[model samples]
Target chain A: MSIARFSPFELLLLKSRSQVDTATLLLLAWVLVHRQHVSEGQRRRRLAQVTAQFRHGHELGPIMSIAHSQDLQAIQLAAEVVRKECSNERSLSALYQAITLATDDGDLSLANHYILRFLADLLNIAPSTLSTLFQELTGKPLCPPEDPSRDAYWQQHDPEYHARQAQEAQAAEQQAKEAHARAEQRQRAQTEKQQKKQQKQQQEQQRQQEATRNAKARAQREQAQREHDQHEQARRTRWQQEQARQEEARRRQQHQRSSSPPPADRTTRALAVLGLAPGASRTDVRQAYRRMAQLHHPDRFYSESDHLVALASARFQRIKNAYDYLMQTY
Target chain B: MRDLYQRLALSPSANSHQISSAVTHCANSALRQDAETVLGVAEHRDAYNKLHKTVSDIGQLRARLGLTHGAHWQGDVANDFSLPPDNAISRHDELVDRVSYAVSLYNHWRRFKGPLLLVALFTAGAGIGLAFGFTLGLGLGTR
Candidate 1:
């Protein structure tokens, strides 16, 4: 694996192409450098990291196909196209992204070196420039040490390396602790937020229940009041009806009493018809009748006009009827 | 009959000569006839006097009882003694009653017309929909 450093101009040149072309070129360069040296999983992870870092708007499917391809000619052609189309600065930036993908697992193998060297050569970059860029990105010489006992030489002469390692180990431990503490804090905040939300929901439910209960009670009270009013109105109506009925009865009784005349006996009427007092004798009745009959006799008025004769006849008949009644009673 | 004497302008104790003179002078033929029937005989005169006295007593009693008019009584006495009775129902009253009844009927129809129209429209629409659906279904089935 190797790391490559990019200049600002080289980064800008790399991004200047259409996003799909840049992404395809980047993926092709990555496949060329990492296919031989890295495992498939490591290559995929590094490809993801490089793509994310570049923020390229490319789908993963076509890029994954490029990474899986074993066609060396296609890879070489893609490299040549990138070299011809882009400036040397853009080509270097694309090569640096490929180197970043290869070196993200933290080591530069001989296979990664050969493929990257091949890509640099195809891009028309000099070996020295490649070595210099690799050195700048990884902080090491591009080639391995010549001594076969490389570890022994570093262990004997570079004590600071071991110190730096220990310092890095300590720094990693501190970062892990901080990350754990942050995780616990996030969890605690989340739990508190959930509890507050639950409490709010419970309060809302209680308020809704209270509102429902109040509505129900109010409805019931209103119903009761309405019923009471109806009953009161009904009672009042009945009372008014009763009062009116009694008044009608009293009025009817008064009308009956005032309208009906008192009874009169027929006997008094008959005695009056005979022109006799209540205590008058049969002789008095007869005398009154004879006096009336003689004055009104039809034969005596026969010589007068016919109207006078008719009037005398009716008068004479009444006198005779009264005399007969008096004679029978006496 | 009780007023026969008053009709002839005669006293109860008048002799036949005075009664005949009054009857001959009476202007109304009906009055003359009533006078002749009531006053020509002693018994008839007595009967008229008795009936008159009874009616006068009743009228006095009603006045004491605070009945302002004899018309309040459901009796022939009111008809016989008071002014002519007025007709209870008039053509105008009958027309008013008929118009009011018709107006009430119109109001009832107005009150119910909207709901009735809605119901009729709903029924008609449902019927049309059902017929259309049935015909379409039959055609589809035959096909």
Candidate 2:
């Protein structure tokens, strides 16, 4: 390679100690030089030139030693120059074609990925975009297949995690159902207690209302009874007053009849009924009438014989009349 | 016997003007010195009241005798009723004199008013400083 062209690739391989073989070097050089052109004649001429320059075994040792001697700053400067030169699609297409040719069995190996990653970084291509390009060019997966050592770890733990999660979900479901049942029971008990309390309060109010009504009825009955007793007493009093008036009238009539002494022809009969003399004053007639009443009153005939009672009644009548007549004459 | 005129610091034959002026001067001096509280000690107020009653009595007696000036006099009453002797009158007079003396001394010392104010300010500042230092010490000790 020319000093100007070799400097950048030297920078890209600065940290790589594994030496590139003659075939890979020639192939990489041919892809870089020939695929940049479109004509078949120009591609053949460039491929011959790259093969003739680095075909010898002795040339690779010097080239690799010189690449190793370049410092990080020099490498970076050379990479910048190369990135400006090879930023187009043409150079990237050439790199993909070269990587495809370098891979054995049409599938990328670890060493192939390392080389592709290194070149893609220098070329300002994203790692993921480069991986896709590598797969497209090589007709294989960008990453290597997982070894059984790594796969065995996941295979051992995946079912355990799934089973644990299923168990946890079942427990949670059971717990939720139990909690719901308990809450329902508690709610039912609370409702029942509230209903009982309400019923008790209603009964208490009913009892109070009944008692109030009973008290009112009793009061009314007592008032009616009191008024009835008062009326009865008044009726009795009126009856007694009427009876007393009747008795007084009867006594006055008897007195009037006794006072006149049956029109006596002489004053002697009248005086005898009165038990007074013919010349008696009004005082003697009154005294004799009072004495006759005391001895032969109707009130004193309770234990007497029937004939004696009649006799005393007639005598009293006569004595009363005679006394009244004497009082008038005097 | 010391009479009412002696208690009022006037002659017995002095006119009303002399008696009023003496009373006014004594009362003004006592009030300025705040002597009412001093007189209120133990029996001092009682003594002063007694002196005041005696002066009032004598003044009334003189006025009544004067009102009957042109009228026919009843009898000779001058030598019959003499004023009673009283130690309270003298004691009250002495107390009033001492109060006046003390008031005069207080007014004289009032000339150093500015220095007294400075001394008061300094005392207040020192008290504040002492309190601040004590608080600072307590805070440091707790820490």
Candidate 3:
């Protein structure tokens, strides 16, 4: 960067020629544009020198403008070349500007048989989306130079356009909030109504059940009262029949006793059959009966018929009942 | 370390049901690990002891053959992989370092016995010399 030790060739290139030719400038531009090995700082410094003519706008104006012009043929050529060959962001931007300027010249039609010119119109889309479309069409990214919305463009359109967008966004947010609140309130109201309706239905069902229960209890009580009345009536008839039967049985017994004569032998000698002497002690009579019962007990013979067994068992029961009754009466 | 926890069916939660489910998931994942790769870790651990015992038996059988310390007595028979405190990778490095250092020391001892033989000879010579001097002094003093 110091001037004292400058190379002779640099001094010659800077001062020897009053003006540089286009071919040399083009060569310099080629090297600066296609530089790969140079460091980034050196590259920028070199490219700045190479493009100084375009910035300063001194000479080579006619050829440079012609090479990138607003003429119909020139713009079409630039567009074609850009789609095919322009790789850098700056060249693409230049081509796009050229196409827009040509359209402004009014040679291209609105829907016509000529070149396409919606270069400025494409700005309506998002830059990223535009870049993607360009890549899809061209097979490579066509990055615009320095994000075309620089201070010059943004200063003109930022306030009113962005303000309108912000307003629309705020309105949409408010609308969504109101819609959500309304939906929640509607849901809560519907839930409360359903709950109240369920409560009323349950209360009605409970009341109906209680009434049915009470009616059933009353019916049961009446049925039980009818059953008790019928039982009492039957009991009275049974008691009356028993009283008549008892009186008839007693009269029959009295008639038999009065009509029958006394035994001629006048003896209580049934026990004498079992070897009991006259005036025997009760123990002696009981011993004789036991001996006789043992000899005649149906259980002693497996071959005994059920009728014989029954007769023996009945005789035994009669003797027992007579003994028990006599003992109590005595 | 992660695989170890997953293998052990250990989970990370306070709720018993969720923890149990997570533990099941961990065990299932461990069971499904590419057995060709990870299954050998267990086999290798088991075979390590087998190799140690075999090498020791073989070396003892062939004590003359130069495989003296083929099986080392000092070794970690078990290793539990877990997240290390302070440094995780350092533990692995430390284990490897210990094994390497032990192996080197065993190799050196097995190969070299020069200084040891020399020390033994020197001590034996000194003992003999002391015994001879004491006997000579006793004989001369008595005479």
Candidate 4:
């Protein structure tokens, strides 16, 4: 309860926030701050007074003109002049005409300018302020609101009111032109990117062609070397076979003369014939097999796993079976 | 003829504003009258007064015509001096065709400025008495 706690905005927004818990507090706050100085009823009455004054033509004077010199003799005549000039409908029309002429022509009587500017400014400020505040608070329009004006019809209907609108329109057109230019730039950039993509593809094709040409040269060189190596190896095997036949003949002749085998071979033959190292543990066999398999693992040949697996299994199984037979027999 | 018809057809109600308005208008209209409009408008005391005694001479000439009448019909006679309606000018009608025009006589009388209203009254007596005496031819005066 106490209303002195809520802020001014909170107080003013009470109409929209009535269902909220703080509404009572806000309303009381509003009354506490403004009610003492100006009550709601008093505000309405004052507004009515203002309207009444408006009807009575109690507006500020914009200009003064001297007319009917002999008739207008009073010393305090200026005060009554404006009201009297605007008394009836015809005079009121004349008064408005004078004001319009003054405004259009400018350099009008000082009085006329002041009065018109004042009325226009006041009316403009009041309604616009109220509208902005209400709109901000209510989140909806305050339609059919009071205008209390005579020129609203002109303002609303005259779409092409010959004010300074043309200047703004020209500026807006220029802005549109700039925006269009930016769009064109974006389009140009997109086109450039597409052109660059085509260029990059052409370059990649050129690099691939270069790589193919280099690969063809490397394959030709490698093929020549491989053929040369095969020829050398065949020559060596032929030489060895020839040497073996010669040596066999010479050894037969020597054996007939000496009847003894070559020492190196006899030694190896004796060892193999005796077969002294027959027993071996699984660890020893595995160690010996690992050493041999390491030299022939699939990584050494960079071969496929399927081919490596087949070759490794066949070789290891034969070795294991021979080793196992030797161990069982001995 | 059109003007005459207009005047004849006009009712008094066709006029304007107030009776005083009509009176004021009529007076002001006579005051502003020129020689052109003077030919047809009413003859009043001011018109005669404005003539500067041209009427007295017309009256003296009319005094020779001795046709008199009994009572005053025109207006009050000034100093009881005026002329009768008949004169030597009327006797000329003896050798010519005679035509008595009342409106013409009234116009002539109005044109005279010197006591025209009074003279018209006095002339009626003179014209009637003279006519009776001329009828008797030797009639004596009755006391």
For candidate 4, write residues A228-313 as lDDT tens digits. 89999999999999999999999899878665433444333322322323344445555654565565444563322233444555
Predicted candidate 4 versus true structure: per-residue lDDT over B65-106, tens digit per residue: 321221211122211224545434332232122213434557
In terms of lDDT, the poorest run of 10 residues in model 3 chain A is A109-118
DockQ of each: 0.00, 0.00, 0.01, 0.00
The residue ranges of model 2 lying beyond 4 angstroms of the native Cα positions read A1-118, A124-170, A173-177, A218-330, B1-143
- Against the hidden true structure, what lDDT does model 1 obtain? 0.58
TM for candidate 1 is: 0.25
Candidate 2, A72-132: lDDT as tens digits: 3232333333444454574475456556544534544322333344455445566567667
lDDT of 3: 0.42
**Reference-based lDDT, residue A294, model 2:** 88
Candidate 1 segments exceeding 4 Å error: A1-42, A53-57, A144-330, B1-143
Error of 2 at A279 (Å): 99
TM-score of chain B of each: 0.44, 0.37, 0.29, 0.19
**Lowest-scoring 10 consecutive residues by lDDT in candidate 4 chain A?**
A59-68
Tell me model 2's lDDT, rounded to 2 decimals: 0.50
Residue A81 lDDT, candidate 3, scale 0-100: 28
How are the candidates ranked when ordered by lDDT, highest leading?
A: 1, 2, 3, 4
Interface RMSD of each: 73.0, 68.2, 41.7, 51.8
Candidate 1 interface RMSD value: 73.0
Q: After superposition, how far is residue A157 of candidate 2 from its true place, in Å?
A: 13
Each model's C-alpha lDDT? 0.58, 0.50, 0.42, 0.37
- Candidate 3 chain B: 10-residue stretch with minimal lDDT: B73-82
